[model samples]
Each structure stands twice: as C-alpha cells, then as structure tokens.
Target: MIFMEDVQQSQATIAMPIDRVGVKGLRLPIVVRDRESGVQHTVAQVSMSVDLPAEFKGTHMSRFVEALEHWEGTLDYHSFLTLLDDIVDRLQARSAHLRFVFPYFLRRRSPVSKAGGMMDYTCRVDGYLKDGKLTFTLGADVPVMTVCPCSKAISDEGAHSQRAEVRILTRFEGFLWLEDLIEIGERAGSCQVYSLLKREDEKYVTETAFAHPTFVEDVVREAAKGLDEHPKVTWYKVEVESFESIHNHSAFAVIESDG
Candidate 1:
C-alpha cells in the first residue's frame, strides 16, 4: 500500500491562530446524577472545541469524538472537568471548551388533587479549561404563572394572568445541583406551573397567583434573593420574562451579582 499524505498536519500559510475549532450540534447519550433518583438518562446536544495553534494547519476534528467516547461514568462537575482536560491533552492544545444542552425531567404533583406527571426543563452546562484551570456554569429555564399587579389593582372583576419563564445561570464554589436553581426560579413567580392539574388544583393556582400578583421585576428580585442566601453560589445571573396577557409586547427584568 502507498503512504497517504497527512494534509491536516501540514503547516498553515496564514499566521493567525484559531481560538476554537471542533464539532458542534452533535447528539449523544448522557447520564446525569439525579436529585431524587440515582441517575437519569438523557440525550444532549454536545459541542466540543479546542484552540488551534498558528503553526498547525488544522486540528484533528475526529479526536473530539474519540475523547468523548473514551469518557465513562456519570456526568457531573468533576467528570465534566476530566472531559475538558482530556480534550486539551488529546488535541495538544492550551485551552478547551465543552457545552451540553438537554431537557431535564422532574416529576410534579398537583397542589390539591395530587395528580402526578413529568415536567421538562431546558438546561445547559458549559465547561471551559484554560492554563490548567477549569470553570463551569449551570443554567436552567423554568416556566411558571404570574398575575399582573397593575391589572389586579385596577380591575374590578378579575385580574389578568399569564405564563412567565425565569432563567438562571450560576457558578458555584462547591457541589450544586440543577434542582436548587430550579426551585429558586419556581418560587420567584406568583405560582409554579404543573403538568397535570385537576379542577381544584387549577382553582388553587389561579387564586394563589391573583392574591400574590407580581411584575417581572419582582420575579427577578426574588430569584436573586434566593441565590444570595445560598452558600455555594459565588456568582449568579437571574432573568425573568413575562408573556403579557393584555399587551402586545412582553415584559422582562434581569439581575446579576457583582461576583
């Protein structure tokens, strides 16, 4: 057999270096640690990349998948860091990055009837490794219900209510679970949303929201307060968006910690 040319190993003509280059929009099966259960199985949209030096023409793109395939066990903070290190070592790069976006499921029960069902939250995890140091961020988007404070105060018959979403991103010093962030987002709203609700549960949620009418500012501030009280959280950003029931535009608010 004749020897083949390794074009990717050839020196680059351009002098500029690529900061990040690898695979994106790759789907893979991942197992994550669950708060109530021992583990959970889910599919994640994964993207992995490493910095390319100016001397090299291109990185070995397939190596990213190889590194991922070599990884085993549950996906957590420690395991995530290990993956990042593996990418850096395999690619012979100074820095590496990894991101996973997936839907996390939780069981929810109705307030009054106790009917139970599964609810899904959009979650994302990001890891960055540079100079032998690793940084991680966890995020979640939680859906809830909110009643308009202005509408409740001005209206005579009833108040206008709409669905809202609270998104939170945080960097923690120690072990932190996605459930913690999810609870904060849920409590910030007027009332939490449920997948299965009976007539009585519906009445309870509607009345609870009406009695505690809130604005987008209130939702964000409440979430910030929760994060502030947490011991593990070193930095956090909270965002709340309300889909207005009576208006043409949506309302939003954001709060971020200095750290």
Candidate 2:
C-alpha cells in the first residue's frame, strides 16, 4: 500500500467562515434584579450571536454556552454588560449580540379593597456591541383596561370597555427598569387590569375606566410623552392595541422617534 496517511493529510481543506453563529431560544432559569424589589426568579429565552471574520473558519460554539453558564442566575444591567464584553472577547469578533425575553411579576394592590396580588408582565432585553460601542434596549408588554372615549361620549348609558396591550421599546444608556414601562402603560390606559379582583374592585375599576376613557391615539401619545421624559432613554417606540368590545377587530396605533 502507498502512504495512505500522507494522501489523507494532503486532501484536507479548511472550512469557510460563518457570518453569524450562536445559540437561540435557550431556556434558562435566572434570577434578575428588580428595581422595586431585590430579586426575582424568571425563565429567560436567550439568543446569542457573533460575526465571524473572513479569515476564521468557524467560531467555537461551545464557548458561547460556557459564557452563559457562568452568569446564568445573576443578571442585572452591569452583569449584562459584562456578559457581552466577555462574549466579544472570547469569540474574538468585531460584533456580538444577545437577546433575552422573560416574564416578570409585580405585586399590585386593588384600588378599592387594597388586596395585593402578583401580576405577570412580559419583558425583553437586548444588548449588542459593534466596533467597540455597545447599545442596550429594554422592553415590556403591559395589559390594561381601555374604554373608548368616542364610545363614552356618543353612547347614552354604558360605554364599551376592552382589554388593551401596550408595548414599549426603548434604547437606554443607563439602567432602565421594566417596571417603569409597565407603570407608564398602565397609567396611560383607562384603568389598570388585574388578575384577581373582588366585587368592590370590579365596580371600582368600571367606574375608574368610565371616568378616564382614552382612544388608541391617546394611549400611544401619552406613553410617548412618558418615554420622552425618561433621561436614560435615547430612542423609543410606543404601540397600543385595543380589543374592541363592540367590534370584532382591534384598534391599533404606533408612535416612534421618526414619527
């Protein structure tokens, strides 16, 4: 037999570089610091990616999982920045991005009875680094009760009340808490929605919403104003969706920096 090892070595070719590579939809249990409270336990769906240079063949995918394992439960504004820095350093890339979506719970007292309960809210965080510059965004989807202003003004007896979801996306340089966005959305709506409510609480919510009817246009505008006043946020987008009780379709509106 001729030299088979020498022939195999000569035939080996280098692999091509991948533009973007990392993990996606990784379900990880984590502890995130809450601004109001100290810490909260949550399950986060995380995605990480890095750009590969032309010279490199492929990035070590296992390293990304290792980095995430180091800070699995310890997540905060500073911790997230550190994680991004570590990923960029380990991957040896010009850019790296991380995204995390989780459900956060907040305790709220009923308006009438003052009974407290936990309300769950959906929240998201994104961090990216490019050319030595880093950017971060925090987002939240808050549910509230909305009564139509036009319906209230036009109807004689009872106005239409419906559930509304407000999504707020913001780019922040400093610490931007998810609770802040939730509060803004709740206040902008006709009334804040609760998971558990008694008879008195229900009556109180009905009256409160009746007194503060708002249109889809009003909801977005108010949320935009609140975001504008936040010092840490440089850019923001506010979107509101109202599930109309009278009609089958929902009313929606969006406001952003460009608008």
Best lDDT among the predictions, by candidate number = 1
What's the true lDDT of residue 111 in model 1? 97
What TM-score does candidate 1 reach?
Answer: 0.94
**Tens-digit lDDT track for model 2 on 1-259?**
6754433113224644555788898999888878878889999999999987555545678778888988746777778888888898887778899999999999989988888999999899888888878788889999989888888898998888999999999987767778889999998898999977889999999999999999999889988999888888789999999998889899999999752
Over the full model, what C-alpha lDDT does candidate 2 score relative to the true structure?
Answer: 0.85
Which pairs of residues collide in model 1? none
User: How much is the lDDT of residue 142 in candidate 2?
Assistant: 94
lDDT of each: 0.92, 0.85
Off by over 4 Å in 2: 1-19, 53-59
lDDT of 1 by residue, 1-259 (tens): 9999877778999967999999999888899878999789999999999998888898999889999999884689888999999999999999999999999999999999999999999999999999999889999999989998888888898988999999999999878888999999999999999999999999999999998999999999999999999999999998999999889999999999999
Q: How many Å off is the CA of 215 in candidate 1?
A: 0.9
What are the models' TM-scores? 0.94, 0.85
After superposition, which runs of candidate 1 have C-alpha atoms over 4 Å from their true positions? none
